[model samples]
Target: MKASAGSSSMLSHIAYFAIIILLISFVPAERLGNAEEALILIGFLGAWRYSWASVNFARAIYFRRFAYPREKERAVKDYASRPGAAHAYFLTTSYKIEPEVTIPVYTSVFTAAAKSKGGATIVSSVVDGADERLIRQVFSCMPCDMSGVKLIIDRIPGTGKRDALAKALSLISRNCPSSSDVVVFVDGDSCVPANIVDQAAPFFTNPQVGALTTDEAVDIPQPGFFRDWFKLRFDQRQIMMCSMGLSKRVLTLTGRMSVFRADLATNPDFIKLIRSDFIDHWRLGRVNFLTGDDKSTWYWLLKNGYEMVYLPDVRSVSMETQPKPTFFGSAIALMVRWFGNMLRTNGRALEIPSRRIGLFVWWSIFDQNLSIWTTLAGPLSAITAAIFFDPIVLPAYFAWVMFTRYMFCAMISLFRGHWFPVSYPFLLYFGQLVGAAVKSFVYFRLDRQKWTRQAAKGGQKAPRSTSERLKSYGSIYLHVLALGWLSLAVLYLTGAA
Candidate 1:
């Protein structure tokens, strides 16, 4: 039954692709004259804007250095000894079932916390059918004492998984002593290093620091080519963006790891806002929740005039996986859901009257939608220049421009001492094409389903996993080429392409 349904979906997708190809082939070349030329010019302008923004963001990251290990230890000792010393509870949220790769890291975190002089309390919240059995199976494998960890396995009625998590945190806050210092939210998949708490401890030195977010780095064993490329590119982009601090007013604190003062979490207005129906809304004035819960929390904290700091030295390693053969389809489905949520969040945000919030709302909209404009501009510009402009010169120039930009990014990735495989540039270009198609499908229709994780393929895979998959799809490319040639021949016979 499942096989038949999967087959039917594949057929439908192929049919849709065929129709699009036919439509594009039939588009009269002459009609692309002026509009295409205009798009090409617009594309150049958009590309220039993106380049400048990226550079400024990169500059910001470079200058904003955090404290070293020894410096951080000193700060932590000072804060721990203060009159009203900040005590933090490590709140770990998990769906009863978690990935096997994360278990070891979670155990390591508990071990580190136990060794800390200040002593951190652990709150493990589990939902659904996830209970003592599942937790024991995963946690027992780790060499850590589970006695200090407080576990809650209660079921949440009439709420989604994410909502249940928020509720659990809220409940935890209510039960804590009024004088408790801080509440640090950490995803189950993330593993905190031994010195992470010490590094982050200093941010509390500033009375205004309501929350602090650490830089997230991924750790994977024997990553495939595409996975390595993605990590390098993504890390560089994130680092550059963080450095700029352009979106400081609306900076997204990653959900994987962040610490907030307990007092802020106990705020009546904040708790009310999180628990309200408005939380269901996608866009909250100047606060965007497009990326997920972390963004929503960051938006709320910033809007309330609370200071949020980015502590690069406070690092946590997260486990990640590469996209499989059906990656494009999955990507489109996920992006559609995210884009719809973002649009909804933006709408909610516009209701706020604060000027700073208003600017943030508008900027978030622009920044998030930049890819859409660039994607459309690329193809339209290419086809238009091919029609009216000096086809040879313009097309070659555009290709060179794109290649140069990609090469520069690749170089930067390498300079950052991250993995930049030889075929990374090609993968980057392919990724852009995939993104354009996904974005187009998303904007054309709204999808309101929660994103589902794809199950990993069984069996051990080679390090060149993506490359192997590409080779496997080589036959499909041949079939596509044959079809393309047949279509072109038919077009010529009918005087079309």
Candidate 2:
């Protein structure tokens, strides 16, 4: 019997583009343009990404719409009556978030906690006393049955997320009822989907699935470029996550909302790692994790061989604010923080061999490192061709990019359940090229970490000690060297040098 499920990739997917290029070559024109080799290289990279993305996109849809439903049903049915204590703990951390965002968030949370079967605990880890008061007021005003629910206020200094989470985890560990229970972490500005608990808690019934994170959508009250940008990002996230979900693992247990089995969440070692996780850089000494608490949890789960699920249908709506005044500024700030977290853990995570971590999951992590280089290849190649080889290459490159990216967006929109905005193509390329640059920057300066939301206070400045200063200078040299080599290779490949 002939097989048919999976076939063709990279060049196979973009043969039509090649055919179009070939057809263009036959036209009566001067110089035939410099798009041949330049586009071929660009075409291959784009095709590979789109090809891989297509596979993930399909897998994501199957898992979310069909496969996951079957597995979830089996889990719910299998463990329906075999449980002992099925308590859930809602651990929410709200620090410096506005009242308007916090109130509705806690209200939805309190309601979710109250509705769970064996009762739940709401541990509000707050920095400001006002946040605690707001939470209490919301809990008090809630109309649901409060008999089985327990409320705890974990007040802490405005240190950082890690400290707050560490304290909250300690509280959960101390009062955890049973290993069969679940612990859900909710960010302050996020509202859980209706019946989130009922939908998510059932997945933990599967013994192999140690944790699960749901999809997220922006619910910002104010609308603008930032809002649309966030929407596009979330759309991309949902597909990628769903694709990862198929392999019984996901790259992240996102901070917006994620559920962990009580046994895993309450482990002392796990709590300790969350509180103080650091990686030793060969050159930069010890790099402490100041933010990206979500990353710490992900590394722990992956290291422990825990299976993670991505619940695409059950999504939490997060209210986001632009961290900087301008979109470009805010984007760079977040990407620096975001990609830094990934790069820091990525080296360590890659140390886990494929046989142990599963091949697909291992490759997914490896792809992160590869993407920073690969994403830049097309644009770099296109620019080189346009500058020296042929000016017509620019127009051809732009046209090809617009056409392919729009097609890519249409597919994403089909899966995302929202029509991609007109700016999707431009934003897509801008994010890819700019994001690659940011990733390159972060990969070198992994030790330089700070929270994007916090004010630039004097004490929080990056280390100025001699050793740190020496490393900072080395980072620039290394970044320049890497890009220089990349540019040289692109030139060599394009025959421009």
Best by TM-score: 2
Per-residue CA lDDT of model 1 for 283-347, tens digit only, reads 21122222256656765776666666665545677765433445455445545555555544454
With a 3 Å backbone cut-off (N, CA, C), the pairs that clash in candidate 2 are none
Model 2 lDDT per residue over 1-497, tens place:
12331233234436635654764554434553445777678878888988888888888888888888888888778667665547889999998889989888988888888888878888889988888888888888888888888999999988888888888988888875465789999999899865877887778777777899988888866666777778888888988998898998899888889999988988988889999999988898787888878989999988988889877778788988888999899888888888988888889899998987789899999999999999888889989987877766765666677678778777889987766556676677778889999999889888777677775321123556877668878898999999999999889888788
lDDT leader: 2
Q: After superposition, how far is residue 351 of candidate 1 from its true place, in Å?
A: 6.2
